[model samples]
Target: MDATGDVILVQGGGSVAATRQTSRTMKRTANLQERLQEKSHAVGERADAVVAPLHGGAGGESELADKAGKSQMLEDASGNNVSLMRTMLRAMLHETSTQLMDEQKKMLERLWDALMGNQRMTTQMMGEQLEMVRQLQQEVQAVKTQAVEESRKVDELRRLHEQSTRQLRVMQEQTSEQIRTTREQTTEQLKIIREQTAQNFEQMRLQVMKEVGIV
Candidate 1:
């Protein structure tokens, strides 16, 4: 084949790959939005259902039904807005997670650069370099601690949400599979974050040690 033909083929392949990736991203976004809408609608339905059982079952059945109907209408309207907000919130979370990952990469690069700088240190500066390593280790530990705390908060929020979801399910007679799935997802995300942080920390330590000729 000619060089020009080869070039065209490569460009075409790249374009196809990029298009596929974009299509996947759009599909995922649409799925997330749909899930958010379902959740919002479910919450509203549960609320309306609960109100009727709580206030009816007597001579006030008609009145209760009317009130519940009105409440459901209001909830349905608000649910649309809530679903949009939740979709936006999920997008924000994805953006934040991506930013954190990028920050971690930048930090590791900086640490490697610092270690490279120390490779030319004389014997006299070895102790100082070791101290700097210690300081960096301490900083990494602090970051790990912060990450743990953040994971704890995330878990707490997940538990609270699960509890609320469970209560709603019990009130309306439903399943716990969705709750379990949500918890698992949250736990998996936290696990990934923790693993990445630890991996970066170890890499930094090893790099520092290599620079000091300890490895």
Candidate 2:
């Protein structure tokens, strides 16, 4: 009996020691799992801190590119404005030159017209003077012809007057000679007639005395 009782006590004591050992191993495994979880969280925080600078650098570069693009656009707009102003000025100058040329052409045409009018007036006056000279020359020729005719008529009248004076002198000389001849003939005839009458009267007286015996 002592030997059996002693064996049972020993077995019970061994079982109790095995149970305490198992409880201690389970407590150690739990503490190790908590430590591993804490280590994983810390590693994730360290990786986030290292990649933060790369993201910030990329964002800053994008902002700088946007500002440069805006500056280039402003410069292009200013250049376009300068070109527009130059074009406008050139157009204005061309218009002014055209207007001046038109005015000069008009003035030249007016001057030409005036010169032509003056030339026509001068020609008309010259023609009038020539006509007047021709008329005066014709009148002078007519007067010269009239003077020649008058001189010829005066010469003819003087010749007729000289011939009439010579005929009158010859007739007066012939009449005086005829009257002297007639007076001589009449005296001779009267002498002869008186002689004959005296002879006849003497004869008749003698005859008468003888017949009467007293003579």
Candidate 3:
């Protein structure tokens, strides 16, 4: 028998080397067993051929022929029994080999399924991780945008405060200048009033002196 069929059956199914080795071993063993069986059968045939004619009795050739027939029948039965044993052993070996092959197939299937499941889970996890990273990036971008907006608002407020401060300084300076101008104007007006009052008093004195007839 060729082990190639068995080798092909196990190809790409996983455990190829072991299966091939086992197949070769099984083939060798089967061949050996078959050779042994053939040898046994040949020995039985030769023995029967040799022993069938040895029982000659006083009944002469008929008795001898009957004994030969009986021996032949016994040999045939023994051969049948041997053939049955070989068939049974072959069936047992076939069953065992089939069972082993089935187990290997099932194991390989389970491993494949597990590997696929793991790969799927790993891919899903990587996807989830990528999504999380994307979300994190978005969040970081949002935070940066918010920070920029806040910074811009702070800058606007600082500018406004500076402008207000400048306006306040300008107003204070203008108020001081206006107060100084008012003080100067009041002083000049008071000087003019004093001079006019003095002039009028002098004129009144002259008029009184002239009216007193000292002209």
What lDDT tens digits, residue by residue, belong to model 2 across residues 60-141? 7754654455445445544544454446435533543454345446556776888888889888888888888888888877
Model 1 TM-score (2 dp)? 0.27
Compared with the true structure, all predictions reach lDDT values of 0.70, 0.55, 0.77
Q: How far in Å is the alpha carbon of 136 misplaced in model 3? A: 2.2
Number of clashes in model 2? 0
Candidate 3: give the clashing pairs. Answer: none
Residue 182 CA error for candidate 2 (Å)? 11
Which is the winner by lDDT between candidate 1 and candidate 3?
3
Q: Among these predicted structures, which one has the highest lDDT?
A: 3
- Hey, what RMSD does candidate 1 come out at? 59.0
Worst 10 residues of 3 by lDDT: 1-10
By lDDT, rank the candidates, best first.
3, 1, 2
Clashes of 1: 0
| Model 1 per-residue lDDT tens digits across residues 108-194 | 787788887776566549888899999999999999999999999999999999999889979655447667777999999999999
- What TM-score should be assigned to candidate 2? 0.36
Which segments of model 2 are wrong by more than 4 Å?
1-94, 155-215
Model 2 residue pairs with clashes? none
